[model samples]
Target: MFTGIVEELGEIVSVEPHGEAARLAVRGKVVTSDAKHGDSIAVNGVCLTVVDVEDEVFTVDVMRETLNRSSLKSAQAGARVNLERAVRADQRLGGHIVQGHVDGTAALLSREPGELWDDVRFSLPRELNRYVAEKGSIAVDGISLTVTSVDEDSFGVSLIPTTLELTTLGARRQGDLVNLEVDVIAKYVEKLVVTK
Candidate 1:
């Protein structure tokens, strides 16, 4: 499990494509400080296991399913990614509970700048739209943010100066794809209600 709080802005050092999967070497000093083989790390909101860790860089294998579901399918060697180590059992939940399992990818639709913040809107997938609600928590690129508004096809989030400076969302432009993970609790609730 993860708190959805970004710990570092890491860079993809390399991407080696195999037949049905890809191996990524990411440079993240803090996340790799104590990381070992089999440890889980959130790369851009997608949870991946550590295959190797060396010299502040960690390697992970991305399966075909993950590639098709996330923006990582088009990830390049120099792309920046949000990194977060899995939450320790004793640590505080800084953000909401995030599984690092991205449901789908969305594109930045628009951005409106505020004096000290920016209100950003992103296209919402039809199936995921029902899970998003105003004031609810969502994970975009692994950084937990609250939904400011929700419509049929898109949603908005207000980003403070800290979020703008700390995460990948700050540099994202219109049409850029980002990974999104709706609240897990909401999904579970829907499942139960539907089966009743």
Candidate 2:
């Protein structure tokens, strides 16, 4: 599991296609400091296993399912990605629990710049809308953020100066696609309620 706290802004070194799947080489010094084969890492909100680690770079294989579900399908060399290592049992849960399993991809609908922050709205998928609630936690591109507002077709979040400076959300523009993972708790609650 991850806490949706970004550890570093990594760069993609290369993307090699293998039939429907692909192999990615990413350069992340911090995340690869102690990483080894089989270790899990969150890349832009999608969990991927480490296939190899060398010279501060790690390689991972992306399956077709992940490609179809996330923005990673269009990932290219030189792109920046949020990186996070799986949480250790003794570490604090600074952010909300995040599985790094992106539910879907959403596009930035608008951005309203403020003196100290940016209020951004993103188009919400119809199926995922029910899981989002105002003030609830959500993971966007592996960074934990609280929803400021929610509606039938879109949701909003306020990005503070730190968030704007640290994550990919700061540079995103209207029509840019991002991976989103709704709160796992909400999904569980829905499943239980529906079964009753």
After superposition, the stretches of candidate 2 with alpha carbons farther than 4 Å from their true spots are none
lDDT of 2 by residue, 69-160 (tens): 99999999999999999999999999999998999999999999999999999999999999999999999999999999999999999999
- Candidate 1, 1-196: lDDT as tens digits: 9999999999999999998899999999999999999999999999999999999999999999999999999999999999999999999999999998999999999999999999999999999999999999999999999999999999999999988998899999999999999999999999999999
TM-score of each: 0.99, 0.99
TM-score of 2: 0.99
Candidate 1 ranges beyond 4 A from true positions: none
C-alpha lDDT (0 to 100) for residue 87 of candidate 1: 99
Clashes of each: 0, 0
Looking at candidate 1, the ten consecutive residues that score lowest on lDDT are 161-170
lDDT of each: 0.97, 0.96
Error of 2 at 68 (Å): 0.4
For model 1, what is the alpha-carbon lDDT of residue 160?
A: 91
Q: At residue 153, give the lDDT of candidate 2.
A: 94
The C-alpha RMSD in Å for every predicted model, in order, reads 0.5, 0.5
